[model samples]
Target: MRFIFAFLAMGLLTIASCEDDGGDSVISLNEGAVPNILKVTGSNTFIDLIALESGEETTINFTVDKGQGNIASMDVVLFYKTGTTVYRTVLESNLTTFPKAYSLTQFDIIEAFTELNSAADFQVGDVLSVSADITLTNGSKLNILNNDATPNFGQDIANSAVYKVFQNYIVSCPSDLGGTYDFVSINIGEPGGFVVPGPETGTVTFTDNGGGVYAISDGSFGGWEALYGPPGASGVTLIDICNTLSFGGSDDYGDTYTISNVTTSGSNLSFSWSNTYGEYGSTTLTRTDGTDWPDLTN
Candidate 1:
């Protein structure tokens, strides 16, 4: 019931079970003790999500114990939202043991989208919610949503009990943009130095500046807009919060260029970029594979 990481990821949450004494096997008004979400040692309370690369899997561990009652089972579920309504789907369910772990793979997420039933494809813009519930043998349910009297020792569920959102990343391609490359213009016939040939081997750096932000490597646009160039070329581009590769900046010549439509092939990167005061050209950068990258900051 709290917001932590904002995306699907390769990490898991571990749950530990409580001892069952088999005393009072009924839900009472005075039932006080609740299960707790174990925090990682010396880390913040936030849970890291899984980005789910190809052939990736992560196991989530949790436990459910009825202190004075007989243990029933625990259900860890996943939910996705559509418009204003939310749909509930079970990721894992019915665990009646201590220190239980449920592992999910990329195939699991794909199955969540289209499996025995035809759910919509999990795209880059979709959000899913994951939560767990413990049903006691006495027919009572307990989860993060059910508020305790003092709101005592528990997980960081946000105000008013809302499930955390999991962002689905269908494509990142961020790493593909980093490498040594040779840039050439697709269409000549324009000025702004869209003709020069030297400097064919420039470096492009991709750094994850935390929170989906990154610093793109320096370059000159056909020797036009230089990020790090000769004589007072002091303009750097920051890939904004949306994690898009689109950005516009002015060169030392005071000329501006809008960069967009960035894509990559097998060691070849191409994008349709244009100078505002000059001409539009499709620039291609053929990257030299396995080039040593500068130390990056996450």
Candidate 2:
């Protein structure tokens, strides 16, 4: 009976040893394996995989999983170093698809590596990273990267990247005119000929009310002269006059003019403008209390 019991105990010990060995085998196979080139799919705004090159060429095979739609296009950008700096270049592939299962694509490893090496300022052993930008027929863009297990890169793919190319044009006018001032001068010409000087000058004082509205006053006229409009009431808005006057008319050629390149000192205001009569003109208005006409210097 003791022999029988000893044999049963030995059998139990063998079973336990087998179970322990099996568990250890499974763990070692998983943890010890070297990571190969991998492609995982999640969302549109995914971070592109960054790969470091070890040789002259490193082939990359990618598989798009189920539930992911047909890839309309793929762009591969290579970033590498030369001498002391890094640079980037793009490689594109024609579109291909499968129905529902995974789609596989192979890339030319050496060409990409060589291109990056030539463009980037890097040494031979410098780190190399790989990434991809993908576009679908539905106008969706995706950036595939290695670290993007979580949902990152947001929803808008077009605006996700930092680098872009654009064209910019600037249109500006002279700044000296505080705001907008029309090119105005009294020619004093009669219907038939030039009028002779009588009381050749009068004093004009301009009071800027901020928003491009000004008040004109002479000691006597007080608020009699129009500030902006068709000389109706003494104080008017500049915009009103610009909308109503004709060029070379008594109404002071009402047209919206841009005032730029302003240079002001003390109580003097000087500005230039692209005149409405297809010419450039400048003016200098000085603060004065005199009553002489054309006394702009005062």
Candidate 3:
């Protein structure tokens, strides 16, 4: 009877060790048997979506480290999706070392996308994803970002706070139109309809409101403040989307505005504005930074 009891205890232990719940919830002590991840660490991972001829370049600086070894060689592939089509280009291959420094330039990105037969050259708001086509030591192939039944790593590992492999870069035109400007405006509305101090000449400031938006020191190009008093027509801001300028948020008097006829010359920006309150002004804001204002459209 003692021998039978010992045999039953050993059988139960074996059954528990080999249990196959066949789900992600299954836990085992042999986690080390899982495939390792490729960790990337860096901060400069975005491409600025400026004109190709603008000489603007983004330098992606990051170090890739193989977690738990076993990787023989890998190919770093650049990928982007357009509509239902996914395009890919090999940026580097035959990487067999750990803690490799991956430095890429914006032109490199352009070349990769161009090589992949991109319908149109990369544009703002496009995303570029990087993945590794790894060759394991035991003669097996694995893609770091493959979404299949037998993925190289689980979500907890993929989205691991410490060990990360996936990387995504967004093509964006970062806009920064903040600082004081030489402002001038001519009021052209009805006489008593929000009168302005004729050809108002003063400096206005564009306070960055983040994400390509700015709050103007004087909403009506100093017209409201010159006539109505302090804090006149506040809460108005400029929304710049890919150099297309527009107005956002109503004024203190709940009056919305529209901008048109925007023109740029050197570092000067001029436009015409009209408010819902029947006030209109032709304004010019010259940049103090000596940098040309982006050619903006309504």
Candidate 4:
């Protein structure tokens, strides 16, 4: 996907250093205590499916404990599983404008998934996992919240809200195919200013079993890196791929990246990867048919 920001004027201000204020509190999972609410909602794809099928006719109700004070805003990262593999999408929401009495609040927000084909791509049995990171404009406190095994396509599921205190959380979705078959896209976005050795460019090869399994590799990486599963399996996890590559090394931080987006069409796939902390540079790879997957070591 292209990095075309609708507001380029805000570009310079977008890249801010992540603050490590000691005021940020980490919640212990055993505490059973609730955190402040800045933002809350389902996955981006969940919202997309709801909007497309229900026409914004759905309402999510939940309340925040506030812990100590009001939460001004929050951001959430949602994950979905295709067989055993997991992909993620991000959503941001602000709820400070709402009435702040320790009661449930309802609101609507957009869940954009321009990459997926349609709402039918998801189903009921599938899971919608959520992780929220909250921030308050006035205080130095941060809340990190996490939830798993959240059911889909119902009002009861909408009523559940996982609360926490801070500005960052990571959610994991277990194996939830939802009875939909989709492809994974691989696209390399624009390189950041701190990229070393500049941006690298190459081609990615994806081969569908004509079923669900797919094999993907980039010539830049020297060999085919099986993406979905083993050479013959139907799905592969993100951890599997990262572990296969052993991303982090003592001297070669410039060889690893964090994949941000992944989408696929028929036998075609497109995904994007960004350099993390001066790690591996960025590269764009095109797909080739019938050709053997490229080697990654060279």
Candidate 5:
């Protein structure tokens, strides 16, 4: 991709050289000037707004190069999305340095939005995109992004593996479901005295494995442990992807399970699970942390 951009730049220089008639039709650019390419360096590309405190932030680092001395300064432009509308503001201006670094806190974004008269609060799933607005020494402006806020460069160059001029960060709400809860379960699929009777009450713990995945202490929530043989169910896990719950792993007998019919009321959550071995259980987990349970659904 770098080679392709270089080739295109060389072609542009050739056209510019031919147009320089040495009289009244001379371009202000140098004889061998090439287009600039914004190269990204080390950086964190996501803004976990949920985890950020009052002074926390995310950062972006990059450099402007390949301009062949024609580049003068650049401006950092920020674009944030809310609902169906995209609003933009000039983040920083007259940046004449190479390998520049900038950090943006949630307050910074909110302040920019306030400048645009936006009263909406930034939320999860919103995207914050950034780009460069370059100015040449000849007093000419060069911007690969069009007026419609879309990249005017070639698709290959925009998706280039060697260079990145634009960066987009998503506001993420990391899932953390690590806690202890009191649960009540009743066996339905395999009735009778083989399973725990009378809507058994017990304690279950959920261990967070990061990124929305969790290791559940009991897969059956005490429905299959006490009566369904010695080697009780284990290795059970659950995934809470964007408030949607799903089951993973199998029991001790290699019977995979499925979770469905998840419902929540205030801070309480309930769900039904069944394994392949004709064992089904309905359980309700009550939160003790006083915080409302996540609005999860299956």
Candidate 6:
């Protein structure tokens, strides 16, 4: 009985040793296993990625995950073209700590692109590339090479690890409103108010008066003399917390007027104008400068 029992135990041990779980859940070193990239988060296309200042940083957010095992590491790479071959260098690399989230900021992408080894004389319209490559501890390359994922940004596919060939057009002082403009139209109505003579050509200039108060020059107002210099009730452009340019001025009729609903549409500046006498008007103006932007073109 003891010999039979020993033989059965030996047989059971041999069978157990031969059984393999296929390494489906965890990576097997001898099998040359690879990890699957479950998802990736990154900007695939840089549209209107404006840089207010040359050295100011633009923070980029990213997250990477794997379907099985542990995510070993991640890389945030900024790349540029050098002829037919594109050279890629890692800008950021790190080991995963639990959540596996990554963040990178380009202090000066415009300047960075200019310093590329094989970079050409590319302008604002030229394209560049950025990628976030992930690596698993199993020595597998989990990249955005596959187009089978979702399209995250600009032409990037889902679960893609790459933001390819993006061109950034840096807008210089986009919110500056100092230029000669044409009077598109004006409508003023209030209690017992007459049609004010709206100027056909008007010039608006913005002056930095310190403390977020702008000294405005309105060439269309008839009371050009009394429009300013009254302290709190003077001609001024106050930039509210919302960055809206609000014009406060007085006309020849001693009527306090303010343009509050200001907006810029391409080459036109339009706004809703109102007065203390309950008069309201919609006024639109177009830049007179031969270029689309009078103040910026020069």
- lDDT by residue (182-265, candidate 2, tens digit) is 222222222223332222233444454321234433211211122211232222222111112111111122223344345555
Residue 216 error for model 1, in Å? Answer: 23
Candidate 4 lDDT, tens digit per residue, 1-298?
0113424523543332133334323333222223444333442222223343564443333334444334555454445544554455555455344324221111222243333444455443233344444466564334343233222112211222453332211111122211112222223222343322333333334442211112333322321122212222111212212112212111111233444334433333334443333323233344444332223221
Model 4, stretches more than 4 Å misplaced?
1-26, 29-72, 76-78, 85-90, 98-110, 136-298
Candidate 3 has a TM-score of 0.43
Query: For model 6, what is the alpha-carbon lDDT of residue 79?
Result: 59
Off by over 4 Å in 1: 1-71, 82-85, 113-120, 143-298
lDDT of 3 by residue, 92-186 (tens): 88777766766767666666766443324666545567666767688756565543212355434543455546565655466778889998888
Measured against the true structure, the TM-scores of the candidates, in listed sequence, are 0.32, 0.22, 0.43, 0.26, 0.43, 0.30
The C-alpha lDDT values of all candidates are: 0.41, 0.31, 0.64, 0.32, 0.64, 0.41
Q: After the best TM-score superposition of candidate 3, give how far the Cα of residue 257 lies from its true spot, in angstroms.
A: 32
lDDT of 6 at 122: 34
* lDDT score for residue 285 of model 2: 50
lDDT, model 2:
0.31
- Candidate 4's error at 55, in angstroms? 11
The order of the candidates by TM-score, greatest first, is 3, 5, 1, 6, 4, 2
Better of 5 and 6 by lDDT: 5
Model 1, span 1-298: residue lDDT tens:
0012311211332222133345444323244423333322332111123333333343323323333334476665555544444556666678666544444444565576433232223333234444455676778666533221112222323211222212122122233233345666554223434443333334455454332333445434344333213432224343332235554334433345566676655656566665554545566666566443222221
